[model samples]
Target: MWDIIKEIITYSLFLWIFLVLSYSNSNQGRILGCNGKSECPQRHRNSTINA
Candidate 1:
């Protein structure tokens, strides 16, 4: 009984987390233009181009 309850709790937690994450990401803009794989460079005005 304990094992079953634990399993159900685990599954519920996972489902809830997934739903929350999906909802949060809905209509959300790109994250840094990358999914934690590489750094995205932003457009910047170069002040020291010849330096």
Candidate 2:
């Protein structure tokens, strides 16, 4: 019973770490957008031009 509890805790910690890492990596991409602008306006311009 103790072993099962330990295993669950370990798995939960790993999952939490994985989720945090993934979120940080995704956020970095958005944060480092075109010329370091988080809210790039080029995307909107291109879309409007295409439309």
Candidate 3:
């Protein structure tokens, strides 16, 4: 009975750690756009023609 409880706790801790690491890694790509458009400044600049 005690072994089963210990196993459950160990698995829960591992799952929590895995979720935290994955969330932090993916957060780097998060960004915001101005003018209520989905375009980023870099992409918008590339699409415009000076002439």
Candidate 4:
């Protein structure tokens, strides 16, 4: 009854917060050049092609 509803609301809130935090973290990683190897501009600039 009311307890079930409360539980559902609490779980949903936690899930929403988790998602928001993860999304922001990923965005920060991109801004800080922490993305994958091939997609990082700083890495590309510091490495030589050796061709």
- What clash count goes with each model? 0, 0, 0, 0
Tens-place lDDT per residue, model 3, 1-51, is 999999999999999999999887763224443442335453346555432
What TM-score would you give candidate 4 relative to the actual structure?
0.54
What TM-score fits each model? 0.52, 0.54, 0.55, 0.54
Winner of 1 and 4 under TM-score: 4
**Cα displacement (Å) at residue 31, model 2:** 11
Q: lDDT tens digits, residues 1-51, model 2?
A: 999999999999999999999987774435646543435554444453333
Query: What clash pairs does model 1 have?
Result: none
**lDDT of each structure?**
0.63, 0.68, 0.65, 0.73
lDDT of 4 by residue, 1-51 (tens): 999999999999999999999887665447776654645655555656531
Tens digits of per-residue lDDT for model 1 on 1-51?
A: 999999999999999999999988764235546432223244223433431
lDDT of 3 at 31: 49
> Over 4 Å off in model 2, which ranges?
27-51
Give the range where candidate 4 is weakest over 10 consecutive residues by summed lDDT. 42-51
Rank ordering of all candidates by TM-score, starting from the highest:
3, 2, 4, 1
Off by over 4 Å in 3: 27-38, 41-51
